[model samples]
Target chain A: MNLLFAAEEAEEGGSGLVSPVIGVMLWTLIVFGITLIVLWKVAFPRIAEALDKRQRMIEESIDTAEKTKREADELLREYRERLSDARGQADDIVARARRTADAHEQESQAEARTKREEMMDQTRRDIEAETRRAIQQIRSEVADLTVLATEKVTRKSLDSSDQKRLVDEALAELDFAALANEERR
Target chain B: MSQSRKILLGAGGAYLLLVVLAFILFGSAGRQDFVPQEEFELPTWIELGPLDINKAVLYLLISGILTCVTMVYIAKRMEAKPNRIQTAVEVLYGVMRDNITRGNMNDKMAAKWFPFIGALFLFIWFNNLIGFIPLPTGHHHFTVLGLEIPTFGIYAATANVSVPLVLSLLVFFSYTFEGIRAKGVGGYLKSLIPAGVTGAMAGFIFVLELLSNIMRIVSLSVRLFANMLAGHLIILFMAGGLAILLGIAGIGVFLLPIGIALYLFEVGLVATLQAFIFATLSAIYIGGAVAESH
Candidate 1:
């Protein structure tokens, strides 16, 4: 039985192996054709589209980022300009205030000087008028004294020339005494 | 035109020449026995001992060398700009690049694996086409302890169950390694279990996953082995049928026309399809192995 099995195995092995090549070939052709068609038509197109969409999305994102950066730069430039303008305005205000203070100081100083001068002039005029009035009062008092003295010395009524001379000499002596007293005080 | 189309044409032409040569050589010699000659007597080159040397290994090595040299020569002579041969190679590269590697893996992963897949496809393709050529048909004769023993013709490396099994095992291990490396070992194991399952269901799923994981090796091996073996078998039967028909006394001459036509058609289709099947399965396996979790 074992010998028979061995003989059968030897005879059958190579022959059985050689007969199915044609059928396998036909089957392969059909399957491969079907696979290729399906892949080319449906699957491959979808995969390619997905890849293209991904590429577009990435490009768009990069573009948006670049645009944002540009906008930020523009805003920064505007802010810098505004800051510089503010600094310029602040300097101008300080300068204007300084000039106005100088003008006010000058005006105040001029008004004060003018008021001092007017007060001095009024004091000088009052002193001059008072001096003139004092001098007149002294003269009248001296005249009255002189007239009393003359009348006592002569015991009678005198002529106009004698009265005049006595009055003049007395007045002269009173003027000299007044001048010396004024000098001592 | 496309490189693939050009390669199809070239390969097709080469195949035609090979078929014509086989018919002229074998048909003129007259009908012989159904069993290949090597089965009865061994070729003198092989030897056996405590460590037996495989007769098929020498043939595979020769086939590999021929394939590599031919492909490299074609690649080198390719035009700087696109020509027929260059276009064919380019299309082959493109198919591997765009479809197999990139389709299966992320770009980073695909870059590393693309070369291996390319080499694999070319090797299998050349081997399958070479089978139709009129090489020495029979077993090898080698000395074993000063004794000679016969072995079968270089079992078209892809046709043997063992060879395809090993290829599949290599793929199986490599992908499993990739999964483990990509995700940690724990995570890799976890990935095998479907999400949203609970308790007993999860346990059941894990068992199923384990079984399937083991079955992956079997499936990969069987798919390749069956395809190549089946194609080879069909070609043999067709040829054998002609041989048997011609061996008959009188009516054999009339059947020659039908036999010749069928032989031409069968050989052509078988050669092309075997290569295609090998490449297609490799693509599918790699695709399945590396697909991202849903």
Candidate 2:
């Protein structure tokens, strides 16, 4: 069998290349074509598709992250704006209240000063009236004493003018408020 | 001893034992003077008058069917979330596509030609690899039970001229067709000579370019075939030297290390390199055809 193949090699080498026979070349072509077609149809496409899908998926993930980040930045900006607005409103309210409080304090202070001035004036008027009443009562009493003394001497009642004149005189002579001022000095 | 050292020693002993066993099986039985003159011969497996099915053809057929089956399986079981086998398959396909298609052509053209390029790469790669695997073919042409099983041994299909010839021819046809399509028939023919040459020099350049173009097919086939064939022959020659001295006891004990090393080199380097060369050359041809560049 070994020698048989050796003989075949020599015989087949007619055109200087036995290895590239017409029949086997055709056979190889046919077989190779079939296998290549199958590979083209099935294997390569699936692999490419998987690789393509992986690439797209990676891009999509990155895109989603970027979008989310943008949205977060937008939300943060909104919150910051709102926070500053609230701060402005709070500051405005505090300033308004402070002005209102200052106004209220000043108004109460003016009202208190007016009320004290009125009370002092009323007290002074009461003191003056009381002094006048005491002086009037003392004058009446002095006039009655003077009438009684004259009546004892002459056994006659005093006229009205006389009583009036006597009371006036006694009020002029007894100045208790002036005498109290002198005592204090 | 340290634990690591102990483990290393144990592993070394085990490896030594395996090597010894391999030498006994493959090294001892090499025939020294028994020149397998028939080993070079390639007769028709089934002769139907002129339509012969030789061992090379049979190996090609086997390679084709297996290539189809494997490719189909890879396509079918592909996952978006790849598992281990899927990852490995993806890596293989990635290498072919990246190096051959995108490396050779522009993106659009690469995409267009990916399937063809990948097919050639994978088919040739598998064919070259399968050649090394030993089958039950006859060793030095022996019979089992009074009946000779012709070609009853492993054969490297790619090592055969017809196989590489067919493959290279396919490439030649494709690239040539692409060239013609790109440049038109008139322009492509006109390109045979340099742009300004008129008479004898033009003719000379045309003849030279024409000869080189024809030689492309020859060189492509011969390169792959010779490499594969030479690698196998070297391995056999070394193993055959074992029977020169120590009978069945020692096979190229002197040559054992070198023989085994050469065999591994054949299996690893030559196989991969040839496949790459074939595919890359095809791409270059296609590139020359479709695109105009320096």
Candidate 3:
């Protein structure tokens, strides 16, 4: 405690280090009080208000940005959905057109086959009729040639009953049915 | 060519210049005092009733005026997109409001006390920062061209015990009043003890707590006062005080660089740090007073 005593003595001996000066203290209080009051009344409130306003502005901006982003996202989703629907409709239309085309092709092919068969039938019937006429002409020519040869061999004109008899014999000997069969083959 | 070599050469050159200057100024002078305690003594420049206008009061007035004007001006001109000075002011405001005041107390209490705490921080910080700057407030004077001019020296009003003492006293009373206001006198005293302690042990603890409470003023004041005073003294001694005292001014050549470094350190960190600590402690005291437990 001797040290404390020495320090106290030093303090008493006009040491400005620890000694309290009333005027300075009073002045400190006065100055500090005035500063506090001035700052409180004028400076601090404005600063606080500005800070609050800035904060609110920032929050509002953030909210607006978020809302816009959400709307854009929604629009994008809707557009994608519509595009997908359009694509699906296009696919269905193509599929239906393909089906119609397939049906039309089948019908046209069947009609062509039927027309071709009827034309082939008509062509075959025409050939058969022409062959029959030609065969009849050949038979009549054979009969007439046979009659003329008989007259020439006999060296005299035969009577009607004789010619008839000769012609009947010649016709009986001829195979007209076989000739027509050969023409058909 | 190497970085270290370059730095060494630069230091050597500076040291040589300082030695030459020191020798030219004080080579023939005898021993001188490093600690001139009288420098702390303020002489009245003006007297009005009980008030003696002096350098300490002058510094306080300047600090107060600057605090008020700078804040009010910045507050008036604030914008959403801040410029450089506005950004700096905003950063300081955030530090005072968020770190010091609101860090320790509830929002209500913080709002109520933010102005006092902010002013305290600004006032103390300005005083501490200006203390490192050499001003024509020295007790000594030199006559140049038949006119007396005060010498330029560094002094801080915070280094004066009375200034911090008064501020600390205010803090002490404010917190004490808050405690009593929050709880009745008896309840506030009872709350000083820890929650579990009872009987005589609780009484002993309460007395100890009360004493600790009282010591806040000394701790708060002395902490600020001693730090500032010590920083200034170190700068003074290292700059030339020791060389002057030892009758070898040439040694200041080596000490001046260290003095410069310490000067930067004090101005850069200690000034702001001390103010922050003072305001933070004030907040904590006030916050603790209103809290349910000690």
DockQ of the candidate models in sequence: 0.01, 0.41, 0.55
Question: How does each model score on TM-score?
Answer: 0.48, 0.72, 0.91
Ranking by lDDT: 3, 2, 1
**Candidate 2, residue B272: lDDT:** 85
Candidate 1 lDDT for residue B155: 41
DockQ of 2: 0.41
Predicted model 3 interface RMSD: 3.4
* Residue lDDT tens for model 3, B21-65: 878887767775434555677777899766888888988888888
The iRMS of the candidates, in order, is 13.9, 3.9, 3.4
| lDDT per model vs. reference | 0.58, 0.75, 0.87
Alpha-carbon lDDT of model 1? 0.58
Off by over 4 Å in 1: A1-8, A11-185, B1-45, B48-55, B139-155, B241-272, B283-290
Q: Write model 2 residue lDDT over B203-289, tens digit each, in one string.
A: 788888888888999999999888887777677657653344334534444455677899889888888888888888888788777
lDDT of 2 by residue, A73-101 (tens): 99999999999999999999999999999
Worst 10-residue lDDT window, candidate 1 chain B: B36-45
Worst 10 residues of 3 chain B by lDDT: B32-41
